[model samples]
Every structure is written in structure tokens, then in C-alpha cells.
Target: MDLPRSFTIRESGHRIHNPFTSEKLATLGRALGLAPGTSVLDLACGSGEMLCTWARDHRVTGTGVDISTEFLTAAHARATELGVTDRVAFRHGDATGHVADEPVGVAACLGATWIGDGAAGTVELLRRSLAPGGIMLIGEPYWRREPRDQATVEGCYATTKDDYRPLPELLELFGRLGCGVVEMVLADQDSWDRYVAAQWLNTRRWLDAHPDDEMADEMREDLATGPVRHVRYQREYLGWGVFALMNR
Candidate 1:
């Protein structure tokens, strides 16, 4: 609830809610080897960028689910703009236990892997939405290096010692879950900057419009310190990637 609203006000202007931009999306598209027609199921599909774009470009058809009414409304507008509203649709609902009515070739649970308890649980949940031999698109974060200090972790919003794992451990975790890492597209600092920095501009815009709104103070505080904290902590110590996995 808090996250969905934060996202709507923060990055709704972004064409893609994902970490990677057009470049990384291209890599993911290529890796998926999508044909002229491929179905996709996107869970935690904030704003529905992936489903809308894929439906337009690859002739895919599927459903998107998320908890945010605002996000679904925006997603619907995106679909209408892309002129693919007939093929793809968006629903406002919790993603933790929701599955597609029918199996799809691609079952995606992007950065919002916390949908099903956490990343590990989300992966298993996404699998259930895919048809046999279908792929699971998992977008998750990994540590660039094992964080040695709590300050670094806290800046990235982690307060626990087990919040994240290094790259090697992350890769192994997928393996232990019985998925073969078929392909992956990682996010560089440039991409992270795009994701985080863009938030500043959006937040500023929101604050401008809602100067007298109840959340103005919180927004102003976030705008003031977001960049500094991101640069000092998240950008340095954390790394993220969208991994394409298949059941082996």
C-alpha cells in the first residue's frame, strides 16, 4: 500500500518501471526469444510497461496483476495508448498468491519479488503461472560485495543482517531452488541512476502540485536527501539484475 502509492507518485512518468532502460529491456527480449506471438503473465507489474510494450512489439497477450489501483489505472491508459488493450489487460489485486487463469510462456515477477513473502517465495509462485518449459523472469537485487557495515545496508533500507546476499550466493540460491540461470541482464550504475534520480524530479513535481497536501513534509524530506543517500549507499554497495530462469 505505502509502496504502491510511493511508486505511483515517484516513477509514473517512466515508460518502464523496471531498473534497466530500453537497453536492458532489449537484452531481456532477445533472451526470451519471443516470436511474433508469445503470451506473458506479469505479477507485481507496476504500471504495466512490460506487458504493454511486449504486447505491442511481440504480439503477446496476457494479464497483469498488482495491488495499486492507481498503477492499474495508469497501466490501462498505457495499453490504450499502445492500442493493444484488446490483447492485454491489467487487474488491481495482491500478487502474493494470484496466478494467471491460464499458463503463459513467460511468467514474470519483477523487482517486487516481496509479493510472495520474499524473492525465494516469489520465484516459486511465478513458476506456477508458467506452462511447462516456460521461463520465469525474476528481477532481483544482489550485493555488489558483501556489505560490511550496517550503515551501508541501512541506507539501502535494510535493517537486518540477512537482508541481501552477494552475487555468488544469489546465483547459488537460484540453483538450490532448482532453476537453471538461462539468461540475465544486469543493471549498471547508469541504470540505477536513471531509476533513482528520476524519482527526484517526479517527487519534486508531486510536491509542487500538492503543496498543501498532508504528505508534503515527507515528500520534501525524501527529495532533499534521496540522492545523497542513494549515492552514498545503494549505488555503491548494491547491484541488481533481471534473471531469466527455466525449470531444469
Candidate 2:
């Protein structure tokens, strides 16, 4: 029903849980040409950053769902801080198999496609809640460069080379799934650093504060190895982006 405590601890300071920075998020919102009052449904919307910011900037109304109480608390605070509490709603629930009660102008599953098994099924899940001609936003990772060995695959957090396709193949996947890619905002190494490096600090801070805690040793190990793994593998081989799609 919730993310692991270790994960919450590692990302305690994050607003947006993914690799996207605030600027890239705003850019994606604008690229969608969201109209004032547009209705959006965001599945697995961590911390509700995209929803709250879009509510403030584009005047879009959205409902965000996540399984983390801690993140939901942060999301609610963000909404209040942004004066967007009236515009966005955060629900603590499983996003998998979640379909909007009403069709929405935008339906999204960002970086948690596992809710529907994978990209194709995730698109189908989102499509069920999308109004005709509405946009579907999917945040996913692709291979920026091919991994050369099983160790490299593990380093990128993939079980096998097929875990993620390259960018072109990913676009082709949308086509095969009856959607057309309309727009995309990608993450660069700098943004990736911002996301991954912050986790190290959070882990270190947590470990220092809870040296005798049961998970402290695990966090310490992660702190010891995470940066090198990220730099050598994920930073070089993985590409992440949020893509906007329309039914073809």
C-alpha cells in the first residue's frame, strides 16, 4: 500500500520524485498547451509537483494519486503553499488499475508504468480515462546507449537489455499502441545529477541521524556505492522523458 520506508527516507527532500527538474516540468506543461481549467488525472503522481505547479501556472485542475502517505502529505503542503489547494486533490491509494470516474483532458502515468505492467498496457489504462482528442502523458526511460553486459544492465537497474527500448523504438511503440507522439521533454545528465545526487545527501543525513537504526547499514551501503553506479551506468546509458501523445 506504500513505498518502502527506505525509499521515502532517501527522497525525503524531493518535490518531484523523478529525474525532471522544475524547469523541464514547466516546459512540458506549456508544451501541452494546457488551457485554463483543463482537467487532468495523474496516476502515481509523486509529491504532486506537476499538478500543483500546473494548477498555479496554467490554471489546470487535477487529481493526483499515490501510495505514499509521506509524499501525499508533502503534496498537500505544496498545494497549500502554492495556493492551489482548491485546484488539485491528492489521494492516497494505489494507482494501478485506477481509471478516472470521468474522462479527462489529460491522463498521465509518470515513471510508474509498472502499474499497467509496461508501456503498452499503461497506455491502454490511461486511454480509458482520456477524453476524445485528449492528451496522454507517459514518463518513461529508454536506452540512451546500449548496455554491454549483464553488470551494466544491473547497474542501470534493468533485469535485461529488453527492459527499455531506445528512443526511436520507444516512439515506434507508441505508434504500435495506436498513439502518436506529439511532444516530449527529455532529461539531461545535469537534471539526472540533481535527482540522483540529492538522494545521496538525504541518505547520508538519515544515516547520520539514525546510526543504530536497523536500515542504517543498508542506507550506508547504498551511500557508498550509489554515486559510482549512477555515474558509470545510468548517467551514460539511460534516458528518461515525459512524452505527450494523442490517439492516432
Candidate 3:
């Protein structure tokens, strides 16, 4: 009932978890065009940043579901800190099959689409939570172009590329899934740097604290090489965005 320790301890001192910075998230929120008091559901809502912000900015109500007790605990603390606890709720459980208690004006699965296999499958699963004509928001990665080698692709992965798709095909896949792209906010190099580079700092902090831990060595190696690989391969060749969609 917990996310990996590595994830739980990432810097919340800044109050963000995703690659898209607060400014970028504001752009995303504007792109979604959520009205005040809109009901939103976010699956795999890491630390509940998006939901909390939406509640604060757009005055929306949301429910964020995640399997990580660690994250949920953080999320609740964040909600309290933001003074949006009354406007939003968080549930600690599996997001893949968990349905919302009520239909929502917006349904989202951000950065954790594997909860339903892939982008298209995740959209299908998220649709059940949406009210008629409600939008679906999916945050996922796409290849800027095809990878040139396995190392290039492996850099895309932490250790190996588990699932990857090219940009155009990803858009088409969503269209074929009975969706019309309403709007999207793509992540740029700065955003990518924010997401990947922040992990290095976290790993460094962890390695310092747990010098004798078995996994420390692996994390150290990952922290050491991750940025080099990301800058060289993944940053230039990969793209990610949160796409807003409507029923076709």
C-alpha cells in the first residue's frame, strides 16, 4: 500500500512532483478550461498537486486516487497546507480499477497510464468516471523520433524501456480510441530537466542518509549516470504532454 521509498521522499519542500513546473501546470489548467466548482477525478494523482491546485485556482472539487500510502499521506498533508482539504478528497487504493464515487466533469490519469496498460487503454478506463461530455486528461510521453539504439532507449527507461511510442502514432492511437484532442500542453526541455534533474538531487540526499543501504549503490549509479543519459538521449528524442480530450 506504498509507493517505492525513492518516490515518497522526493522534494516536496517545493510542493511539486511532476516534471511540469508550477507555471507549466498553470498552463495545463488553463488549457483544460475547467470551470469553478467542476468535479474532477485524477487517477494516480502523485502528491495530489494538480487536484489541489485546481481546487485552489479554479475552485474545483476533485478526488485523487493513488496506491501509495506514502504519497497519500503527503497528499493529505499538502491538502491541509494549501487549505483546500474541504474542496478535495484523496483515496489510498489501486487507481486501475477504482471507480469514482460519482461521475465527474473531468477525468484524468497523469503520468501513470500503465494503470490501464497504455494510453488508449488508460483513456478507456478513465472514461467511466466522466460525466457526459466531460473531458479526459492523460499525461504521457512520446518519442520525438524513433530511437537510434538500445542504449538510447534504455536511457529512456530507468534501466530499460518498458513501453515507448512515437509522437504521431500516439496521437493517432488516441483518435482511434474515440477521442478528439481538445487541447494539450507539451513538456519542453526545461520541463524535462525539471522532472529528471530533480531526481538526481533526491538520490544524492538519499545516498548521503543511507550510505550502507544495499540499494544505495544502485541509486548512486543511477543518480550519477541518469542526467548524462537523459541529456544525451532522452531529452532530445522524447516529448511528453498532458492531452485534453473529448468523446468522438
Candidate 4:
């Protein structure tokens, strides 16, 4: 299976699918202080960036699962490029309910937590594959400010404001799940701009290449309005971070 063509096209250039930049991702890896040969299982690991990079930098061994075949291909290539092909493997499959064949030191479900429906359920799903006292890496979005109205919610690409909680509430959620927030690295507006603005260019280039495609019109419309919408709504209202958690 694969992600929608539109999504794959829009994010084709991205090494990390979420708002995270390579530097932020590297910082997270360092913060984790992963030991050599540490075992990691990354769910919904787009392009296997975290797994591949960590394999190279921390000497970790891991498997990554994602539904997107295109991304899996990129992941394999990334592994090769990083000289970690023997250390990391990527599988094309649904990440939801995916349990590792063996317990892992780090179990992560980043960005696509909807695989377990939401953050709490996602944490539970990750725990199923985690070794005792292992870390759970969860990447989620929180509302930086309350959306003003329905228009604001729509602008943030959410159906309702309930889609995300404020930062404090999100931390409380981890506590409620019987985990403590150990470490976190957040995305700033610059990284957000880098992520969202890059999509605009990708969409524009794709539209030029596939002028007759049926999706062109939709992409065109999105490219036309995406920047302003992101600046006004998502950049201001949405805060994204990858949190490191441990059982309390």
C-alpha cells in the first residue's frame, strides 16, 4: 500500500515527513543518548530518517514500518547512503498494532499517531513492543493558542479545536498514561516554515510537470493559498514536538 499520490508528491523532497528539520532530529537522537547496538522500533517512520540516521550516528539497530511504498524505497536508499544498510530495515505495512518480533529498547510512533487513533492509544500500542523501562518516542502536535473560531480550526487543517490540546494538557496526558516526559525537542516557526513552504514549491513543480493530471487543479488551488493559511493559522496555533517518555 502507499500514501495518496498527492501526499507523496507534495512531500517528495522531505526526509522527515513532519515539521521536523534534520538538525532538530539529530538533536533528539543526541538527547536520547542511545547506546551502541540499542534496538529501536519506529512506527510510521517516514523515509526511515530517524532509524537510518540513528543507526549511523548511535550505532543502533532498528526496523521501521510505514504504509508508503515510495517512502520505504527512499528509506532503503537512505540506509545505504548512511552505510547503515545492515543495521536498519524498513517494512511496508500498516503501523497500527505493529509489534516488534522482539522487545525493543526504544519504541516510537512519530507524526502518524492516528495509527492507534490518538496519542494515548498510540502510546499503548508502542508499549506493546517496548522492553521494560524502555523509552517511548511520541511526536505530536499541541495547540499553541486556542483557535478563535471554526474558521481558525479549518485554517489549521483540523475539523475541530479538540484535535490538539495545549502543551500543559499534553504533558498531563503522558502522566495519565503512566509515563513521565523525560525529554523533548520542539519545532520553531522557522522549521514550520521550512516544512510547509517546501511543499508549496514541490506542488508547483509537480503541477508544471503534470499539467493534464486530474489532481493538478487541486494542487494548484492549494499552492495558491497554502502559504497565507500556514502563516496565519498553523504557524501561530500549532506546536509540534517529539517527546521521550519513560514509565514512572
Highest lDDT, which number? Answer: 2
Residue 18, candidate 1: Cα error in Å is 3.4
Question: What tens-digit string does per-residue lDDT give for candidate 2 at 12-129?
Answer: 9999899999999999998888999999999999999999999999999999999999999999999999999999998999999999989999999989999999999999999999
Model 1, span 1-248: residue lDDT tens: 53546657788677667668877886688778887667889998888888888888788888998887777788999999999999898877788888888888999988888887777898889988889999999888888867778888898788764777787788898999999998989999999999989989999999989998888888898899899999998898888898889998
Local accuracy of candidate 3 as per-residue lDDT tens digits, 162-240: 4767777788888899899999888899988888788788778877888998788778777777878888987988888
| Candidate 1 lowest-lDDT run of ten | 1-10
Q: What's the distance in Å from true for residue 61, model 1? A: 1.2
Per-candidate TM-scores read 0.95, 0.99, 0.93, 0.99
Q: In terms of lDDT, which candidate is stronger, 2 or 3? A: 2
True lDDT of residue 162, candidate 2: 98
- Sliding window of 10 residues with minimal summed lDDT for model 4: 1-10
| Candidate 3 worst ten-residue window by lDDT | 6-15
Positional deviation of 35 in candidate 1, in angstroms? 2.2
How high is the CA lDDT of each candidate model? 0.84, 0.96, 0.83, 0.94
TM-score of 2: 0.99
Model 3 RMSD vs true structure? 2.0
TM-score of 1: 0.95
| Tens digit per residue, CA lDDT, model 4, 1-248 | 77899899899988999999999999999999999999999999989999999999999999999999989999999999999999999989999899999999999988999999999999999999999989999999999999999988999889988999999999999999999999999999999999999999889889999999999888899898999999999999999999999998
Ranking by TM-score: 2, 4, 1, 3
